[model samples]
Target: MRCLKMLVIAAVLMFGLTSCGVTNHMISNYNVSQTQLVLSKDNFRVIGDVEGRARATYVFGIGGLSRKAVRENAIADMYRNARLTGAQAVNNITTTVKVRSYPFVMEYEFIASGQIIEFTGE
Candidate 1:
């Protein structure tokens, strides 16, 4: 009976932790600014590339920022890091979400990336 009970406990623990390894990936595009401009063929040049990442965790479905807030925070972080000048802008923005699911917790990582460009002419 002792061996049988130990076997049952081990099985239950294994089953419980199985959800810890689950992960999901998602990608989407968003507009960070209201003023949209069409990049001219020869008016702007790529200055560099930038990326911003943010993480939020929730346990038992309660904690941290909401999904929408996390995404916005990631984009805002990217802009804060860029420190764009008067004639500089960020383009080709993409946001990636990494979700790690556990039995009682969820971890989210939001990554925002884009290329910085500077206009050579008006």
Candidate 2:
């Protein structure tokens, strides 16, 4: 009986701590400027930094919508924001979304940057 009670407590604790929102650190690492372009020299290109973020209906625990919908919304927002900000090009994009604690759901941040590469043919 004691062992059963202990197991139940552990399960509850685990459930309480589990999250499915997102984090800023993960979003900061994604690249979205590729689609966004700016006028550079004579040609238009994506430049500058790209970032992403998610807005959850619930701070934690995937309360409002389906996981797929939430993810799509977040990515769309990032793209929209990045494009609006005037980026030349975004590359090497990554994201991480997860819930933090209970009743404190949060969305991770997105980040991306554009790099100019030069080729010299002599």
Candidate 3:
């Protein structure tokens, strides 16, 4: 039946899309750098915070994934990427993930360049 065929195609498409994972590559590169720093650091701490960016947000297909899953993935990636750059936490740090959609598939980008800040405790 036509309905059955459509269902099969939809299932395949969803599976392929979800398997693609999060679209936070800039963050991924950062993670690489952060990891490198961690290897050389005498002390390390993990910080979490959120901020907004001027650029249009990015949105990837949710598929069956929850928003929490997506955000967490991005945050973890941000931490890993920051480590690659040799930037250890001076105090605390925050990175923002912006989600926006276009005509085609949604995009999920890390708007962390200017949004990140080094925390200093008094």
Candidate 4:
């Protein structure tokens, strides 16, 4: 009976830790800036490459993890990083998702990358 109780407690603790989704520290440390720019013209010149990543976890499909949320977060992170470098736009954006599963827990990571650009207006 004691062994069974211990097992139950351990399982609950693991679930609690894994269900918290992404951490605030991870999101806050990206140092993304809030700036808007138009990325639809050839006048923009490439400054450099930038990337963002976010993670979500699911346990027996109980967690409210969604691909849309992961994707949005990744893009937001990318934009923030770009803006910090004084970039006026981002282009050639690409997104990728990776999945890892272990018995009851499944984790997904979304990554976004793009080239930072500035409008030359030639």
Candidate 5:
């Protein structure tokens, strides 16, 4: 009985000191700037992958822009690094948000990634 009590106290201390985090993820389809452009298996070839990340901190749930804006900022950052010139497009865009909580502070990290493809002559 004494050993059991000690174990319970240890467990409680461990849990109390541990911090928990939450994550939200989402994936979007093709988001090319061109609307009339048609992409097929034979029309495009995978060139490489592009990724971008953005982070913001909140205290007492007050700070930074809205969630949608943050996501857009991440995607915009990805585009800046994509270096698209011509006949290039990015698809399979995915966005993931991770929120880490500590005391009265929370940090949110957003990551956006996609596949960069270049059109191939038919």
Candidate 6:
């Protein structure tokens, strides 16, 4: 009976942890400038730095998580953050992925960061 109770407790704990969904992070200023272009570093003048991240957790490796999905979500978040900074565009974009593993679960985060910029017609 004691063994059965311990097993149940462990199962509940695992379930609780797995059910936790994605986490996100962002840093930006509220006074954003409106613009219609997503530019590269060479095409724009960087005004400030912006960052965004998204995380997804998998239980027993069962969730159909894909890199493309994660990356897209992170990029979307970055764009939103850029808008918050009133950027005309985002430049110098960089992306990274982090994974953590436990006995029966894994958590991964997709992180995207970039510099907010304006057009420099040089």
Selected candidate, larger TM-score, 2 vs 3: 2
How far is 88's C-alpha from truth in model 5 (Å)? 0.4
After superposing candidate 2 on the true structure, give the runs of residues whose Cα lies further than 4 Å from its correct spot. Answer: 1-46, 57-62, 84-89, 103-122
lDDT by residue (49-89, candidate 5, tens digit) is 99988888888999988777777888899988899888888
* Strongest candidate by TM-score: 1
Off by over 4 Å in 5: 1-17, 30-41
Clashing pairs in 6: 32-85, 32-86, 33-86
How does residue 6 of candidate 1 score in lDDT? Answer: 100
Against the true structure, what is each candidate's TM-score?
Answer: 0.80, 0.40, 0.30, 0.61, 0.76, 0.58
Q: What ranking emerges by TM-score with the best candidate at the front?
A: 1, 5, 4, 6, 2, 3
For all candidates in order, the CA lDDT equals 0.81, 0.49, 0.44, 0.70, 0.82, 0.68
Poorest 10 consecutive residues of model 2 by lDDT?
A: 113-122
**lDDT, candidate 3, at 26:** 38
How do the residues 34-87 of candidate 6 rate in per-residue lDDT, one tens digit apiece? 345644446566688887777777788778457668776887898887764332
Summarize candidate 4's per-residue lDDT along 1-122 as a digit string, tens digits: 99999999999888766532442222322323343455565656668999998888888876845877887798888877876444366766777777766657878888888777777756
Residue-wise C-alpha lDDT for candidate 1, range 21-100, written one tens digit per residue: 43444454557464356655577788999988888999999999998899889888999989999888888788888888
Better of 1 and 5 by TM-score: 1
Runs of candidate 6 exceeding 4 Å displacement: 1-44, 84-87
Better of 2 and 5 by lDDT: 5
lDDT of 3 by residue, 25-107 (tens): 23333333243233354444445344333222333543434554555555555444554333434122334555555444554
